[model samples]
Target: MAVGALAGALALAGCGGGNDAGTSAGGAGAAAGGAGSTGAVAVKNVDGVGMALVDSAGKTLYFTDQDTAGSIKCTAACLGFWFPASGNGVAGGAVAGLSTVHRPDNGQDQLTFEGKPLYTFKLDTGPGQHEGQNAQDSFGGTTFTWHAATTSAAAPTTTEAPPANTGGGYGY
Candidate 1:
């Protein structure tokens, strides 16, 4: 009887692992406050690197750091602005070289790139709204900037000289 009960409990747990409430066990569905769902977002090659963004079911309100390498320095008051996405606490599926790591300060798993930590901006509100891209801010004379993904294909360069200006020049 004891063994039978244990098997039933395990089955129940596995069945609950796909809904919003079951997300704690690696389920799907979004969280409150317009955050992303625990479901794995489809990753595609954006330029040369692998990238994933919030889907239609999920709101892109949080932001992650694109420059930090394997270390999440955001915590305490920082979490209030940029909340981390939860659920099985891992970035699931095959996303090229993307992976997850634990934030020692909060015990939350964070997505990493080449072992470096990544983050989202607190101000982003939706998908395709990449206002945080290439953004630069200065703190104590140190400049922090978002990194842009590079394309794997080579772009064409202009080789011809520019035509002469047709408009009149203005001078003081």
Candidate 2:
């Protein structure tokens, strides 16, 4: 029941207005595409989860069970919690399976891992936080399960931190 309550509260927060951050797909995309920005995808060692996919800011990225290849089902209110990884920046390092999917709604390209749409959880406080792992919730009438992005069938360890974009706005 507590899980339900938390999901409800988060959903409500997603519905509220005045988000200066702007819920538009373009808000986070700009920072993701700025000049001198390095590749957006990287593999890092997360606290309990070992190795997982992280964005330019070293924040954990996730894949949803409800989304399919080349398409994203999360939109409108759903984008509130699950911010799509912008399909900008070069694929630095040797991170494999990095690609982008064309979002039909706003024409914003969303980053993909192994053909799966990628997203970051809004509630995660910082890097190494896998708060959205295995989370089950429904938003905009869609039910989905979220999981951390892993390098392969098994998680690998990497000492390097993801590239940093100091001017970017999508951290924490």
Off by over 4 Å in 2: 1-8, 11-39, 88-92, 153-172
**CA lDDT of every candidate:** 0.40, 0.70
**Residue-level error in angstroms, candidate 1, position 132:** 0.8
- Root-mean-square deviation (CA) per prediction: 17.2, 12.9
TM-scores of the models, in the order given: 0.45, 0.69
lDDT of 1 by residue, 4-121 (tens): 4533543343234323232231111122232323444333333322243432233232233533545455443333223454433223444454456776765657555445454444
Q: TM-score: which candidate is best?
A: 2
For residues 58-155, write the lDDT of model 2, one tens digit per residue: 77889998897756777655665777887455445667787888888678677887888888887776778877877776665777788888876465
